[model samples]
Target: MGFFQLLMKKKELIPLVMFMTVAASGASSFAVYSLWKSDVIIDRKGNPEPWENVDPTVPQKLITINQQWKPIEELQQVRRATR
Candidate 1:
């Protein structure tokens, strides 16, 4: 049988194949995004320059702390008071 017919006969493999394809595509996309977001400075010759020569104008991505959660100490105090 041809490749397509063989694959059709094995219906159980379809979901696994689809999941792997999607997972691979997502990974590739994320890899490209990370590379694009990197701070490497390319020279006129299309090669990356040293880290010291990179432009300082680009803003770095900052990690934000979640302010929604109350402090554990305060929570403990409140719980003790309520009891």
Candidate 2:
């Protein structure tokens, strides 16, 4: 028999099939809306910040050296001794 004839014979499954169709359509519609909104937001934000326009005269710290490994108590003692 055809698919529609089978469905007609089993009347209880019609509501379940209809509910699934509605749920699937709603989920897909929501997904499309979300994608559209994301695109609109990205377009509105415009181009990203340019990195090439940085001031060359500004002093920049290129390297940091932490050579000392003194304990907190020793540091305090050293500060008192210096004073």
Which pairs, if any, clash in model 2?
A: none
Over 4 Å off, model 2: 39-83
* TM-score of every model versus the real structure: 0.48, 0.45
Q: Candidate 2 residues 3-80, lDDT tens each?
A: 789899999989999999999999999777665432234443453433233343443333435444434788669868
In angstroms, the error of model 1 at 10 is: 0.6
The residue-by-residue lDDT of candidate 1 on 1-83, one tens digit each, is 98678779998888888899999999999777666544644353665545434444554444435434334788669868988
Name the lDDT of candidate 2: 0.62
For model 1 the TM-score comes to: 0.48
